[model samples]
Target: MIQVKQLTKRFGQTVAVKNVSFSVEKGQILGFLGPNGAGKTTTMRILTCYIPADEGSASIAGLDVFENSLEVREKIGYLPENAPLYPDMGVIDYLNFIAEMREITGLERKKRLREMIDICGLEKALSKQIGQLSKGYRQRVGLAQTLIHHPDVLILDEPTTGLDPNQIMEIRQLIKEVGKEKTVILCSHILPEVEVTCQRVIIINEGEIVASGTPEELTNKALGGQTIFIKIKGPKGEIDSKLNNLPGLVSFRKSSEEGHNFYRYEIKGDGHREHCEDLFRMAVDNNWILSELRMEGASLEDVFRQLTAKEK
Candidate 1:
């Protein structure tokens, strides 16, 4: 429901986004990730029509964002990092004002207001001024206003910022429910949140997209191998020699030394073979007691750091 083609933007001599292109299908939630000064917000601003791109085009639900700015606005709901709110307005009044601005009136307006209040859990705060609400409630109010018009697409920038763990989970679940029927582009610094909530992820760096894939795909792509952790009770010197000689093992290091001659080791393999069976046989031949063995892949955070970190 959203599309961009080689979108580029500049501020003076600095290029904020360059040749960036991607799409979000209906009912899909996309995680847009990047480090600070990486042009993530700039691209979001262009997509939401807050700013124009210097090159290329963006469209929402088949309408050009630049040519049909008004219609495009009608099709997408944007909740910026700092929600645009009037601190003095009560929650109900604020939502009503936004509904009116969206041209929703009469019976439709009432229905939408009720829906937003219910969906955003804003009933208790309806009578309170926005400034009086807690940070979590303020975010809820921001969400209520954003969804007051029931737009087809949702663009959220740091929606969970400043929220406590409980509040963050609440908003995360809410976004998942909304993504059941709406296209969503979520921008968050929280890697775990994005890993669990988004269907796909796009990582941008230095004004360009460096990676795009499912979490599993990106993790595997980044590591190009499997990480194995094992604990064994044996002579440390013999274990090290055997590990070094294991075929297809990329590298191995002693992670820790447990009491009673047990040691923990981390091993890396070339992703082409399994080492557990070989290690088990070797341990049996040498009468070494094995305690722990497990393999893990790289995490989203690992992939993000490798792709976006400066100095190559």
Candidate 2:
């Protein structure tokens, strides 16, 4: 439902985004990840028509964001990192104002307001002033206003900022539910949140897209192979010999030494479960005690670091 091609933006001599390109399918939740000062917010602003790009093009549902800015805005709901809110207005009043601004009036306006209150879990805070509500509640109010117009696309930047663990989970669930029908572009610094909630991810660094893929695909690409952690009780020389001879073993390193007999080892090899089986068989053949053996796959955080880390 969204497409960007060769998009570039600059401020003075600084390039904020450079030839960045990606697409999001209808009803898909895409995670946009980057380190600080990576132009994430700048890109979002361009997509929302809040700012124009210096070069290239972006479109929402086939409407050019620059040429058809008004129409594009109609199809998009944007919740910026810091939600714009009036402190003195009551929660309900604030939402009602948003509804009116969206041209929703009378029965439809009241219905949408009630629905937002229910969907955002704002019933208890509706009568309270926005400034009196907790940060989490204020975030909910922001989300409610964004949804008040039922836009086809939701662009949320740091949607869970300032939220407690429980509130974060609640908002994640809500986003997932909303994503069942609407396309969503979520920007977050939390790797685990993006890993768990998004269908696909685009990682950007130095104003350029460094990687894009499913979580599992990116993880595998980052790791290059599987990592096996094993704790065994055996003679050090014998164990090393056996491990060295194991098929598909690319490298091995001693992680820790537990007493004189037990040792912890991390083995890297071709990503396959058979490697673990091979380790167990080798231990049994040598009459060595196998205390622990488990395969560890690369996490999203690993992929993030691999892609965004500064080159030596």
- In model 1, which runs have C-alpha deviations exceeding 4 angstroms? 233-248, 254-263, 270-288
TM-scores for all candidates: the values are 0.88, 0.90
Clashing pairs in 1: none
Clashes of 2: 0
Q: In terms of TM-score, which candidate is strongest?
A: 2
Compare the candidates by lDDT and give the number of the best one. 2
Q: Over the stretch 1-312, how does candidate 1's per-residue lDDT look in tens digits? A: 999999999999999899999999999999999999899999988888889998999999999999998899888899999999999998889988998898899999999999998899988988999999999999988888778888899999999999999999999999999999999999999999999999999999989999998987788667756798899999999999999899988899999998999999999877667688888888899999998988898889999999987783
lDDT of 2 by residue, 19-130 (tens): 9999999889999999999989899999999899999999999999999999999999999989999999999889989998899999999899989999999989978999
Off by over 4 Å in 2: 223-225, 233-242, 245-248, 256-263, 270-274, 281-288
User: What TM-score would candidate 1 get against the native?
Assistant: 0.88
True-structure lDDT of candidate 1:
0.91
